[model samples]
Target: MRDTLRTRVRLVGATMAVSIALLVAVESALAHEEYVVDGERDVAVGEFLAESLTDPFVVGPLLAGAVLVLVGIAGYLVVPPVERDVGAFRAAMGEYRSYVPWLLRISFGIPLIGAGFGGYFISPAVHVQARLLQVALGFLLLFGFATRVVALLTLGCYLIGVVVRPILLLQLEFVGGMLAIALIGSGRPSADHVLQRVAGTPGTLYGRLDIVHDRARVFQERIREYRTLVPTIVRLGLGSTFVSLGLGQKILRPGIGLAVVDKYELTTVVPASPELWVLGAGLAEIGLGLALVGGFFTRASAASAIGVFSLTLFALPDDPVLAHVGLFGLASVLLITGSGPYAIDRRLEPVETEEPADAVPEAA
Candidate 1:
């Protein structure tokens, strides 16, 4: 049974990877198209909109939905003469569910890369816009794949871009990106599979009881092992975000740190003179990022850093739709996941207790 499940998982992964690659190829082609022709932008836009209406945006999802239906049909056909066993059906469905994250990553990543490259090649204004879009899309992809750290970093880029420049184009981009992320994030699998696997048995009163006890023990052990580590992760995240922003702000305009802030008027957020607010914001960011990296007061640092980014969303409401969307998504991940596995929390965990004390208590 385990082997079968593993095989199915591998198949699903392979299919998902292929699907993502195909989607990326399509997006890359579109990006190249923009750079290849002069008058082609309008034509390209028209074709893209038309294609979106006819194909992947509509037809492609329909096709995928149809494939799912076929899987259901096949499962029914394979069921035995007696009562139909749902184990295999459930396994197949689980495999499909597991494939979703990979698919979303590919879907978001390819276009972002294409857009980034396109931006770099286009006029300076377009280049700046494209980079912001790239950061937003990249964060959305990472968030879709449960890589919270990567998402946060990308989001930082987006937010900084806005703080540096607050304009109408950037605002629209932010909104668009947010909507995309919302669409992707709304469909996550439940945690039930993790519980079932850890329990090592199907549903039964005794089995459930054992699973619960095991989970509780595991949770306690993990907490003891990584008590200090969790805080460290948060601190590192905070420090990195702050440092990046501080450096950027110190050298560039406050609007420069944020992309949308610069899209309109070139004036800096800090008035004409010394620009103390920009410098202060930068220093704070550096402190927060360094603290996070050092593994101190991690949760607080992460929370603060996230709050800073959230504020940027409001500060540069006129930033591009994609940029705002990306930052929002990135901030959400940092708030939820913190630093993840590599942080100090993993290192500080206490050693596991060999047996329950009651099982082998010392004889009186």
Candidate 2:
């Protein structure tokens, strides 16, 4: 019974994650279509819904939904019908308890850093001091996640000292990062224990209560573990869609950037030489997409991309709804999820200590 419940929870979480990912991909494809036809196009929710509901594209969502259903069904079939061991179940639950808070940190930290950089780049003179503070905050956040108590304390102090603090936003990244680390550091609960617990339980009040409490505890732990990651994931999905569309325009239509800028009347005072900037921006976006997908130096790359997108938003502030919305979404994602599973950081754990050379001690 416990094994069954645990499997059910895993299936549910995985399904939801995949579904969200598919939805984002569908939205991205639509955004690309709009970008190609009209550089300065806007998409309304109703129109988007109607269009997505049609052929070919509709298949994507349907497939994702189907996969989710299948997983749920599989979980139902595979989960055993027995009472599980309590002690082992508790141990399993404890393993993942710390993951939630860390995830929340990352989700929030990425954005706060980006916003600081965006502000810095937009008007250096005006935001120089603010930019420095933000950069400092970002580093402190990274350090905090790596188990630096001093960094965490400093962050706390800064939060209290700042009069009009954007505490919620900052906390979001901090929490997300912390949760992800915890999750990775402490893997899933013991499948064997869960199976045992389920096998032992019969249909009594105590048995039911044990099952209910275990399920609830595990569910809460999973929720806490994933809640921070979810926002970041959402941001990544939306950001990837917009960035991909923007890149598509450049690829499909060579002079799409200039055309887009002109159509949007983005530059009241266009640069005497705009081609270079446009091309550079396009290339930068392509690189950003790759970095995001690859998850290399995720926080830094995402921050830089956010800076670029934010600048675009300012330049073409009066553009169509989708453009602004897309840019906002991209910036949000970069801010929220610095880099996910695909990130290179995952493979870059520091070497704790070097092994001694293969030399034997002479004459002791």
Candidate 3:
């Protein structure tokens, strides 16, 4: 029964993860459609350089540095083994656990609540019903209250919202985040943890918030177990984003790609014609994107993506540069870790199967 429940939980998680990847793809296409400028156009090189500097020149390395600093502090200062880590130390505690499953929930949950309240108080003409509910979701996530329920419902809310902004259906990474929440539940240290302690039994409580998994245990062990999830999400996000952009903007609409490329004024810097460069980049993206999706040569593709996206960052204007920054981060992860457990790279690896029970065991 425990195994069955675990399997179900994993299934839910997988579904959510895939959904998020798709969502990013869809939303990105729509977002791309809205793009109107080639960042390095008629504007002076000085102007471009000035603007680029303002937008974090190296998004991944910098954000990564911050995370590492926080982790260092977490390992040194918060160093777990206690409970006062809550109230005054909550923010610090969060940074300590920022890379864990619970981090995704809190990170996303805060925004949901903000949007909910913002809609309720500010947007006089938006999805009133959804906005009101998101406020509650924010609180639930913050407290880790009925987490699985909140996760499922949040996925539903995303689906409903997608009907309006069907483009969100493309945002697969967010879906992956939700899936992680549903599968992993809110680590330890929440109302769910407290209630589970009160129950003192290993079983489901309040539908699927998971009270049995030691809700009383303030901090989670086996942090290493969830390590693969980060890469999986990264693969999906980077793969899907490239596939959509390459197939949609470059390959299929080369004319449109040409139009965008024509705006680039980097001829003095780059010897190749802008239009030819765009076409060549499109083909390169498609090839690399396919490799990422297939999980073949995952590291190579991801590394290429880092370079490709970095250059694209320079070519595009403000909004796209911001979006590409996030892409570079995703690519950087796959570059470091490869495709992860779920990829074809792993699947194709040779594994020794156990000898059949009825057959004589083979001599080593």
- Top TM-score model: 3
| Candidate 2 structure quality by residue, lDDT tens digits, 1-364 | 6875575457436534542343333323322223222453343434433444454444454556558756854564377332255224434533433332333333334444664666631111123335666556555444332322323443353334222332122122232233223322211132222433454467655545454445534544454433324333433443343344444444333345556656655455654233433444545565565555555545456566667656755666543322233234334444433343324545542321111111111000
Per-residue CA lDDT of model 3 for 234-308, tens digit only, reads 565566657766655555445455556566555546665544454455656666776776677576577778787
Tens-digit lDDT track of model 1 for 187-287: 33322233334455566565566535465445444333322222222233234334544543332223333222234222455342222333345555656
User: Could you tally the backbone clashes for each prediction?
Assistant: 58, 41, 16
Better of 2 and 3 by lDDT: 3
- Evaluate all candidate structures by whole-model CA lDDT and list the values in order: 0.38, 0.40, 0.52
Task: Please identify model 2 stretches exceeding 4 Å from their true place.
Answer: 1-216, 222-239, 254-256, 264-278, 320-342, 348-364
Misplaced by over 4 Å in model 3 are: 1-33, 36-151, 188-234, 264-269, 306-310, 320-338, 347-364
lDDT winner = 3
TM per candidate comes to 0.33, 0.36, 0.50
Question: Model 3: what TM-score?
Answer: 0.50
Q: Local error of candidate 1 at 263, Å?
A: 11
Question: Global lDDT for candidate 2?
Answer: 0.40
